[model samples]
Target: MRQKVFNWGRYPQGDVDLLPLYYLEELDELTSKPCIARGNGRCYGDSSLSSQVISTITFDKALIFDKKQGIFKCQSGMQLSDILDIIVPHGWFLPVTPGTKFITVGGAVASDIHGKNHHTEGSFSKHIIEFEIYSGEGLHYTCSAKEHPDLFHATCGGMGLTGIITSVTFQLKKIESVFITRVQEKARNLDEAFELFEKYSNHTYSMAWIDCLKGGNSFGRSIMMAGEHTTLNELNAKQKPEALKLLQGSKLNIPLDLPSFMLSGLSVKSFNELYYHKILGKVKQDKTYFDQFFYPLDAINNWNRMYGKHGFIQYQFVLPLSTSRAGLVEIMEKIRNQGSGSFLAVLKQFGPQDGMLSFPMEGYTLALDFPFRPGLLKFLNKLDELVLKYHGRLYLTKDARMDAEVFKASYPNLGEFINVLDKYVPKRSFSSFQSERLFG
Candidate 1:
């Protein structure tokens, strides 16, 4: 049935026919139409949007779990949160997890999602052992680094254009507890932030909450957080009893769309100031629940509504390690001059690139949330030019408005990715609005 659907960002919404695929058999029947697989719809943009969407929500099922080996197999629709519930108590965790636990296995593979540990563990596809996919020709193929290598690479970050991922088998990281030993350091400026990141490069996970709204002497001031899984021996007396305790349900929620004015420059600036000062020290150390450290925003439901009815776009891009410092200086100046500041700005160091279309590379990646407003798109386009000038590219999973020319210039492997799609995806049989927008 045709219905309106929106991604997590809630921008570029459209009405599409959503076909629910309940059983594996249904994959064959859906081949008659050009459709993209839709999981929990947590992607930030149009990558999952299409005229015909094959909903995998009902296909969720845990197929096999070798707890001893920390290996799991499940249907594409199984959510990361669900996997956590079953694994955390058993001392296993996702090898790589994005900021949210609301996305599905299929979506993870499609986006080749990276997490705070990208500098150490790479993206989600790195841990995937193999997966089953139903191609546009209604044929099932098992893909991995050793088998159908090209399809595996393309499908890993193909944005669901190559086929519908039915099931996935991946390795999990074993943990002694569900708590994280965290250290927070205050960076007075951009240079200190970079210094801190490099200084603590050995930490299992690291990221920074940057104050993009601030300028001059305080420009790029941030709280650099680094953490590692707390071992059983490191747990406090009170926490030892529940070392592997699972995260409880979130109680906080944004019940309604906040007024647009709530996110105005003045308001956001205030929030940033408060958040930055909340640490109360130059360096602080503490132990927190895994969820708090890895998925802080997940504690609030419908938090995207905080951006207001028009929604917001998450602009994430990476610059080569050599040019990152200079590139960010230029981009930050441009944003400041334009009077557009993002309160929710994140900075992380990525280790290396994997997969044909994966977003991560050996560099620093910055993500910022900008409220959808007039002139914002034009402003972003200008920033896009600066990004390309630095030899960087925008993340496809987070993109909504990048032009075809810009995308072509950024991704040098576009032709290879397209070749994989052309060979496997029958003409118009499996595609998305993003694919059309970028590849057309």
Candidate 2:
């Protein structure tokens, strides 16, 4: 248990692990040497990779809470799930959440993750009031928008390159229950997809699960899901009583990965057809479980292994809505022409981004998961070219392949972001796969 532990990469291919450091004393001791700390190891690529990774999960501890203010503080390794179990029933939730709630609070800050409500709530950092970060100089300090403000911005999405996040404080939203009242629409093609996005721009959360293999007039055909938390009074007493209990239960994890080919294109196509039929139309206000809605893939343990040992790569990019179609079309074309049809593809509209170096922009973003194969780099590079042509950018948290030149171009504001970055630690230390591969 004290040895190195790795993950399936979600891309379902590479086998990489972290040298777990389960205590704060271990983390402090790591500063003398180049090191990066990570939690859950969920980032698809090497962003969390480092010769020395302080697995901060042992740092887990609930430090403070004020119900009236809805402001909560806890150790960096605290999982959002831990907070949700206590707060959701009380009618408050994380102001924002990523696709899966399995991520740690520290990881959320390091990545500046955005969620379905991004258009409205922005990224996780927007609601973060403050956090405790141990710097490269072996010094510990607290930072926020008001104190060491420069480091605050840098650490927001700095990928933990400036310091090891120790503890964090954030504002939680009060919610009625763990249920979402959603509306679904089926689009015949990408054009219809755009129309629906524009039409439902006001929803608290909006996203689309696309069918990537289908092209032509039907390219980007999808099911646009729009929703918000259901109010307590809106539900019957019977449902309310059940909702509270569901939040407290433990969901089982996918214990082992399946045979890689279990998620082949042919099989995925059939699944997509079924999903389109089931979720696309006006379905009743059917009772939904948070696990299913928020973390679809989490249901199946080691689900990525369905892609086989080659491991698939996730290609995700955001394009200003004005150019989403053209950029998307070109990228989709490249994927299909390369005979690399992804098993799962998703599309969503990003609202205005507030983070200085946030990944989500005011536009449309698409993510595709495909089985790994030779020539993938060539295909992804071509897609990156198309993304750049449209003034769009890629998600570094989910990336394992992009180079620094491309990254610098993707975020020209990086200079300003980096200026904010160096202030956190005058010694200029800390590391991540990103620091090694893209920021070196």
Candidate 3:
């Protein structure tokens, strides 16, 4: 009814009116036109959306779900949390999920999003079977690795540039319960973390949190956490209910953004310290709802507001195994030397690269949140050079910086991806700051 444009980080952006279209004759014809697909609007960056008016929400619904084969066929606009609400009760969970469940299934596939078990499952493409997409030609087509391999490869992490994904069918994972039996292993230093991860990686899931401010023995201080869904026996009668479902009956928005100064190292460090210590120890049988287990941060309404008004950018990248340790040391040293305060820092071990443009690789990947500083662009430029020097690359989904030439040099498959997109070249679509910078 009204135009309301929202950015994931409350970053610089203007309002866009999202027109509504359904699946009937009027809607079908509308959807068949040239347009960009928008999901829960959780790109963190702008690749998955455009400024052009598109009818995305009107077609939202789970088109199909065959529990028999653990296959889910749903509208592209369906949010992951919406799926979890119905899936968990049936002993099903998303095989790979990003940090927040607010993202949509289409967004996950378009970005080829990876998760904690990236070392095991890869990304959304690995689980995705097929998709129905409407292209710039105003026609829907089918694509998959086995069918239209070229389109499928390009569409995965294509940033919605190739076409508008209308529906996707993907494999679902079977789990015993919605609860995760977590183990919180506190590491005094980065070496302890490397040791712990290498030792416990045989477990189901692995992820760690690092204190970007510390160094020496405390340099890269962190806590390594691993977990798996609890079995029926692991859960008591009270813990495993027949119909304990995730609730999403409500949603809230930040009315206005706050000042950039709202987030500082001191405040962020305090939050990180409290978060780290609270979950320390074995935590052998800690229990939680699916939401709490998968997306704990989502509990806070307008959580992005904590970053302040100027809006922050997430610098995430992966360093190959050979240079991971050395590269990480240098990056951390530089950050410390420059007095750059990180609001949030996450470290994850990547197993291997999957999709054509997927970001993870066989090494260590780290994500850090920083407020926009005067020379932030230059700082990232320096970091980019180092990443390339170490045979590393940055994540496109979370990036608000990086040039196209740098991206092409890092990802040799850029040309191939572009060629595939040529089949359905969009003429009048909107891209984010990162998209423009990397592929204008």
Candidate 4:
């Protein structure tokens, strides 16, 4: 059936022929078409948009799980939330997770998702033992780091163009409790934020909520947060009994689109000021549930509606460690001077990346949300030039309209990724609108 589909960002939506794959046998017929597999649709871009799309939502199921060894094998369509439901009680958690838990396991691998722990654990694919993929040429193969290593690397961040992932087996992280011992510190400016990040370099998770609207001395002011999984001994009297309890689903919902004016510079600046001061003192410590600490946005259903029906673009990019400070200063200055404010600005330090097309490297990454208003893309294009000048690149998962020239210049390993795709999906039967836009 033809239906309109949009990624989490709700932008660049289009009508497509949607095919739901309920059984493994169904993939045989779908492989011949040019399509991309759709997970929970949280990519925030058009990477999963195409004329034909295979919906993997119904293909979710756990194939095997060795609780004792913390090994899990599940169908690609399984969501992180579902896995958390089964593993949290067993003291296991995802090795690496993005901000949201609604994305599918396949989507995680495809984007090679990273998290607050990227400086420690790397990307989601690093812990992957193996995965089964049905190639565009009607070939099925089980790939891993040792076997078909090239295919394994390419598929990890290939944006689903190499093929459709069927099942994945990966290692799970063990946890003593479902709580996180969190510490919040205020960084009056970008320099202080960098200092605090270095001071807490040993922490398992670290990230910051930056106030991108501020200029001059207050520019880049942020609240830095670091956390580690809480142990049973850390739980207080009332929390000891249910230390491993799972999180409940969100009750809050933004039923309709909000007024676009609600996110104006004045409103956003006011909100940022309030949020920055909400931390109280220079430093604060507390124990929070894993869900609250890792996925705060998940607490509100249909939260994307807050950007209005026009949708928003999540502009995320990373600069090489050597150039991060200068690059960020220039980028933030441009944003400030433009008078465009991003209410949700996140900054994090990344250690390294492994996959050929993976987004991260040893650097600092910043993400901002911009309403899809006129001239936003043109403005972002200018930012792209600065990123490239600093030897940085935009994340493909968050990209909606990056040009081919910029895309090619940013990823030095593009040739290798293309070679793997050509070798496996020679007919190019697997493709997406974004793939054509950036790769063709």
* RMSD list, candidates in order: 1.0, 2.5, 2.9, 0.9
Best by lDDT: 4
Q: Clash number for every model?
A: 0, 15, 2, 0
Rank by lDDT, highest first: 4, 1, 2, 3
Candidate with more favorable, higher lDDT: 2 or 4: 4
Q: CA lDDT of 295 in candidate 4?
A: 92
The true-structure Cα RMSD of candidate 2 reads 2.5
Query: Global CA lDDT of candidate 2, please?
Result: 0.77
Name model 1 segments beyond 4 Å from true. none
- Measured with C-alpha atoms, the lDDT of residue 59 in candidate 2 is 77
TM-score of each: 0.98, 0.92, 0.91, 0.99
Candidate 2 C-alpha lDDT tens digits along 347-397: 988887755566889898898875666777777887888899999998988
Residue pairs with clashing backbones, model 1: none
Question: Relative to the unseen true structure, what is the C-alpha lDDT of residue 37 in candidate 1, on a scale of 0 to 100?
Answer: 96
Q: What's the alpha carbon RMSD for model 1?
A: 1.0
Query: Which lDDT tens digits does candidate 1 get at residues 337-371?
Result: 88667776999999988688898989999999988
Q: What TM-score does prediction 4 earn?
A: 0.99
